[model samples]
Target: MTRRYVIVGNGPAGVAAAEAIRRHDTAGEIRIVGGEDTGFYSRPGLAYLLTGAIPEESLFSRPASDHDLAGIHRTVGTVREIDPQRHRIVLFDGQAMSYDRLLLAVGARAVRPAVPGIDLDGVVTLDNLDDARRILRLARRAKRACVVGGGITAIELAEGLAANGVETHYLMRGDRYWGSVLDPYESALVEGRLAEEGIRIHRGVELAGVIGRKGRVAAVETRDGSTLACDILAVAIGTQPRLELAHLAGLQTGRGIWADATFQTTDRDIFAAGDAAEVLDPETGKRGIDSLWSAALDHGRAAGEQMCGVGRPYRRPAPFNVTRIGGVTTTLIGAVGTGARDVDLVTLGRGDSNAWREHADAFAVVSDGEANHLRLVLGPDRLVGAVVMGDQALSRPLQHLIRERVDIRWARDRLSRGPIEVRKALQALIERTVPLGAA
Candidate 1:
């Protein structure tokens, strides 16, 4: 009898796992169970959809026909329980499905504060398609909006609301935006750009409570005793891993579901990935949350490959992040260490182009003057981490450096000296990787 492979959750990791499993095991039964009502779509594209830049139909990462043609069964439902001993899952409807191998890709959900009036109308959290749609609906009639948090999601929400003509206010507990990924200088540059777009930013502020009128949010009270009047309150604080199922099933979890290099859970037959899985960063050697879409896809693919008897060890790469807010584009790779020991600081330009660089083995180049910055962290002549801003032309090369760890010190030194032959070397690298047609 052919073995059955069951995957829970329909996000990027879950979907990618199904495709990867089919790649190695041609005849095995593959079933994907997800709590989402709609089929798989790109989570990152949700922000774009709100801006009307992309149609809802365009959000689907894979066509429905693709799943059908692959002989994969996609079930839209919730998995309430996992029975690792029996290698089975119990759905909310009490239906039990046996599996020879199970993949737990149940992603994280938005964390709402425990403050009062959270249940009031007009307050929303964007975690999935449904949440996005609801927020868009509220945006249509919203005059004033408040976005709470300081991550990429908060920036996206604040910008999106402002674009729709809503009076937007960004509430952050930190002194700078994206404090985790960006240095103080880069954060200031981004903050300045948002301010130019007419978005008011309040730093070092916390959401104390929500004042409601007629069961709808009227204003947001901050811990500083200042209240901002708004028609909508969007909570983009952060996400908590959905580990109830994993914990209940007796799987080892800390910070996130603990998995080895092979992406396997404590139970040999079970595996976990995506936002739910906490994997170590190869560069920092620290347990980190990989909420990015690319990381999740790679995690699922690795898990699936391992499940299919492939003798492959999962390679955890440095984390990469990219975001555009108020027409400013920023890309970050690896951790921008908090203090001085792990990183060295570099600055380029003054005023608008001023950006702070942090690296020990890593080098960051910020051209805040030209709205451009590039950070490269080298490990034994290999690029480990990088951040690019303004000019995205160098993103591909930076990504290549991160992947191949190319020795471009000669080219980098040349650019530093007099900008003599940097373009030639960069073009050569591009030609080697990107196809001529695409180039």
Candidate 2:
């Protein structure tokens, strides 16, 4: 009997799941439903598109011919509801598709906060390719652009606006940039770099409302009674999982739609993945979405395998994200921000290593005078979390140590000595764990 597998998205996760299903169940019916008409494209590449690093037409993850070759059926419609009892999903257009197994990988939607004049013509979000095109059009005559929010997306938007020769103002509700992930020291380093790039930083200010002139955004009004002139307003606060269909399906949900390690939902036949799925950590019993591109791809593959009767749990290392913003390479590994107050933080400051800077510049161009800071989150006796800024050489080793739960007790004294000796200490610890020949 040919089993039917229905994937309710066309993003990285959903596409990966479909391909995996085809690989395992060669004769099974595989269908991918996407609300967007376009095929899969790189969401991360949207930022580069703003700076002309990539052409608008080059965002697709794969060629148009590939989906047909894979024997996957693609549909354009939103999954409005999941009727698990009937083993079918109802589309927004009232079309119902039945499946032996269903995967919900609908991803997330970008948010625009409710404020006066927010519906004005000049205010837009760069969530999808369409939004990117809209922003590109607006950027042509935009002189002063104000980006609201303190997340990575907001920072990237601000950088893109500045790169396009527009005067950029990064308005954050908090006093520090990325305060959730960065400490005072780390935040200062980022703040200084942004200032050097002529991107004005306004912190601890609440966005009271947006002011418009003749149906177009003219200025941004703050709660403190100050209004900053702006030709465009871009908001990149954060993202919430698209879980309306999951809720309608009567699936248990928390941060996102709850699924077990195998991506199995409340109904054994229904699975979930991508930004929409809050997978439970088998070890800790915690349910949350990793929301990373790599994580989503892996989850889809694992879920696909499980659906094919190859039982294996989807296990992932602690979450990490690396990005170069404002000419500074920043890497956040593990639960760096969530439990910072509980762990022992080791701060190492390396003030302008000319040699190190040159080495790193080859990979990613950073600010000329930006200082490097490496901080490790040590829990009990093992390396757990790390924040690498300016210099990313330590990012890989730190990630490995955290993932492997390697003990760094032998380098405790050397680590406390500060920046100069910290690298040596890490090298020593690595050499000890690894054989001499391997080192």
Candidate 3:
């Protein structure tokens, strides 16, 4: 009998799930439903698009028709609700699709502050490719622009706006940038780099409300009792998962739709993944959500295999990412602590779980300098987390140690000895655990 598999949300997770299912069961009927017509393009690439590092057409990783070659059928529509009992989902147009098994990889939406004039024409959030195009159009007429929030996206917004020859102003509520994730030194490094690019920084300030003229953004008022000329206000605060369908389906949800290690939700036949899923972290034994492309791709594959009746449990990989911060390349590994909630930077600073800040209470050792910086978070007997900036010599080794729970307790006592021993010790451990050609 040919089993029918229906996957919701057309992002990386949904697409990966369809491909994975095809690989496992050739006869299975796989259908992917998404609201976006662009099919699958790189969400992370949207940042580079803003900076003009990549052409708009270059944002596509593969042609939309590529999925048809793999025998995956595409349906474009917004799902209104899911009825697990009937094994069917209703589309917004009142169309319905039934399935033997369903995967909800719905993803998330960018958040903006709730204030007056938010509905004005000039305010936007850099969430999707459409938003990116909208910003590019607005930048041409923008005399001055302001970016609010912290973390990588906020910085990218400031840089992208400044690159268009518009005067860019960055507003942060904290004294330093990304206070929760980056230390004072790391914050200073990023903050200083932004200043050199002609981007003005406003620390310890908040957006009280926006003032509009003719129903478009004209100026903004800060909580500090000051007004600034701002034609465009880009918000990159954070994101919230879309869970209306999950709720309608009667699935258990919290930070996101709750799913087990196999990506199975409360309803056995229904699964969730991507940014929309609050999944179990194989390492920490805690469930959390992620808004990253790599994580979503891996998540879809695992859930697809499970839907195909793969008996093995999916071991979520460590949060590994090599990203650009203010033109500097950096790599992030497992469980580095989180900062205060005000930073609103949920994208990269944390790990597989949002509770990364709980581990922040632990002590850390640092290898500090002008450009290169490394901080290792040590638990009682192993490497819990690490933050690598500028240089990446220690990144791969530290990732292995933290991900595998290798005992680096011996190095804990040698904290005062310096980074030389730290690097040597990590290399030794990687040699023992990783194979010759690996690491």
Q: Which candidate is the best by TM-score?
A: 3
Off by over 4 Å in 2: 338-371, 434-439
| CA deviation > 4 Å runs, candidate 3 | 282-285, 338-355, 419-421, 424-434
Candidate-wise lDDT, in order: 0.74, 0.76, 0.81
Tell me, by lDDT, which candidate is best: 3
Give the Å error, residue 178, model 3: 1.0
Query: Quick one: how many clashes does candidate 3 have?
Result: 1
Model 2 agreement with the true structure over 354-429: per-residue lDDT tens digits: 1111111111111222377777666557766777887676677777787777777777677656666766777788
Return the lDDT, model 2, position 377: 65
Best-to-worst order by lDDT is 3, 2, 1
Which window of ten consecutive residues has the lowest lDDT sum in model 2? 344-353
Candidate 2 at 288: error in angstroms? 2.0
lDDT per residue as tens, model 1, 1-439: 8989999889888888999999999999999998877888988888898777898999997887899999999887788888888888989988888999988898887777778888899988777889889888898899999988656677777777887889998887767776545667777888898899889988778889999999999999988888889999988666777899888789889867888777888999888888888765445455556777887888899989988879477666655666685577877665444333211011110000101223445554433445765544444444556667787777765665665556665456533332234445456656665554444
Candidates sorted on TM-score, descending: 3, 2, 1
Better of 1 and 3 by lDDT: 3
